[model samples]
Target: MKWLLACIAPVLLAAWILFLSAHGPASWVLLPGILIGIACAAGLSFLRSFSPALRALSLTLYLLPLGLLSTYRASAFSVSKDFELGALPLASAPSEMSIAQLPTGVTYRSAAFGYRGGSLFEPRVFSMTAILIKHPKGDLLIDAGFGRDIAQHLATLPLPFQLLTRYTLNKTAREQLQSSGYDLTRLRAIILTHSHWDHISGAADFPEVPVWIPPAERSFVQGEDVTTATARSIKSLHIEEYRFDARPYLGFAESHDVYGDGAVVIVPAPGHTPGSVIVFVTLADHKRYAFIGDLAWQLEGVTEQEERPLTQRIADFEPRLVREHLAHMAAISARYPELTLVVAHDPRSFASIPKWP
Candidate 1:
């Protein structure tokens, strides 16, 4: 009876929290968590020395410390961040062509809590963004975002990840572009910030288009998966080797001008993924935008240098590198608040900004 009580309490608590933190935060989160917790408790109870108090205390220590530490760590991270407007250095320009920013489709809505640890426990709606760069030479799409069949991608995901992404797909990138009256055929190529499913799922919509991938991130997907199928079908993937140069600027050593013109440039911002990069778009109006690809899920993560919590980090390609990169990004943003840093999946940040010229 004592062991049974111990098992029940932890199962209920774990399930409740897991369910709430998921993207959809559905009641479905309860079942998996409860089952896992029960299995764990059963294994521990095999010990003859196990008692109710001991079991409860063990679970308490494990669960309580993780949450408390996450909150405390986020607070400490926020405290470490600060920047000045005058300290940002501007480098020499390479071209004078004007570019336009156009975003397609609705941002795929998600939650701010467990999906992104930087937002604390708040359950605010977030987005998976898809942006278009209209250049004189050709237009480029950054982060393909969601598609009509986003559920298929989510279903193929492993374990905790599959359970985490439970949000609805508002529309596909292609649907957004066509509805917005943009010429989809004119799209020169698709630029993937990284090969994450949400960002690449919609690539299937534009099969004939050329795709550009970062040198560092080309191997993000290791095994045979849906991402591979999408990538393999691309018309061509050029390293754009000549454009990729090892020059120090914008707190990064490597940068590339998309069109051999200074209108659009890709900069190394590794950490979120080893190959993750950011796009620096300087419009004809002189306004500059940095499209950060999952570097920080929320802008607050940049301001506070708070990463996506410990548990979330476990699933990341490289969490330590991610934290270091987050710190660097926050420092850059701090020094130049005027340099607009657009997060890929943050709807609030994307809302105030206009899409396409």
Candidate 2:
């Protein structure tokens, strides 16, 4: 046991140093990784004391270079910079004002599935979706894609989830929003569907914009589930929480009117996470667009009725009132053919929408 500790102590120390150097002392993003690594080292060392085979297997597992190959293969795809920045193929352009979908930034498919039981072989893959919305008032970003640093972080560590290597922030969503004629200073507000790392990475990009977060998600972001740096970052933002109100949009429950004029509506759709939400945008001509974040990985979840199994879904994440709110969205989408539902992280759906400036 002592020998094993001596061998792993250096590796752990090096990881800690690297983490601090990259993000500073405030960076606690890798806390989970550090905890898991230490636990594994301790458990394996104890086991090695009893069995030589266990010791050999532990050493071999740590030495394996498969994680690097996985990261490389995952990051192979490139995001398209030149997406058609206009309306959908079927929708007619509004004659009053130009309503276009702009790709503020692009995201790539990461290995789906978040950490579970500390096993890399687990077949779970969480979807990574990002969107940029350009309104006459100002440019609004739905969710920020995973930053480059996160991909690099995942590559070296044996995290259970896939790293989004292919997706690069070709231009920060902030830049795209600015080019689209939206001033960050005047930027009315930024709404996060949830506080997951992928969705909130770009929050730093819009520090000035008042962020609207779900009340349920407040605890998660403020709690130990997130890194101290991340929590602090979230705390620094101007955050407002909305009670689930299923009154607006005709049967959709639990939403906050971002602009008050009904231009953008933030709806609570919890299942994937406690504070999962959907952003609803109403164009000049009263056309509606729903930015549903991670309700389903692909559009198929909403389109083909293929959602995660009931057992796998988060039940206590959102209160019963919030769950009913999600049902309202489903029902409204079914009834309103004109209302466009945007699924965050789906490449096909993102491709179908017009890119932002």
Task: Locate the minimum summed-lDDT window of 10 residues in model 1.
Answer: 101-110
lDDT tens digits by residue: candidate 2, 1-357: 555663464455444433332222332445755675675567555654645765666565554323322322222122222322123213232233333443323433222222111112222223344455554456556666553344432343234223222334455566556666765664555678777656666666666766667777776667655222343444446676766665544544355765456666776666566677777777666676777776655454555433422212332243343334434555566667677777665555555455554
Please estimate how well model 1 matches the true structure, expressed as its whole-model Cα lDDT.
0.61
**Residue pairs clashing, model 1:** 83-334, 101-356, 102-356, 217-275
- The lDDT per prediction is 0.61, 0.51
- Tens-digit lDDT track of model 1 for 1-357: 555555455555554454455453444555775675675566456435686667556566447424633442434543343323243334333344443334433322223442334333445555666777766576788878776656665566666656655565766778777777988778888787777767877776776676677656666554454434444433333333224688555666677876664667787766666677778776655677778877776676676566665454544566666666677767677666667877776676675466544
Query: What TM-score does each of the candidates earn?
Result: 0.76, 0.57
Which candidate number would show the highest lDDT if scored against the true structure?
A: 1
Off by over 4 Å in 2: 1-139, 147-158, 162-167, 178-182, 226-238, 243-248, 309-330
Which parts of model 1 have CA positions greater than 4 angstroms off? Answer: 24-75, 78-121, 223-243
TM-score of 1: 0.76
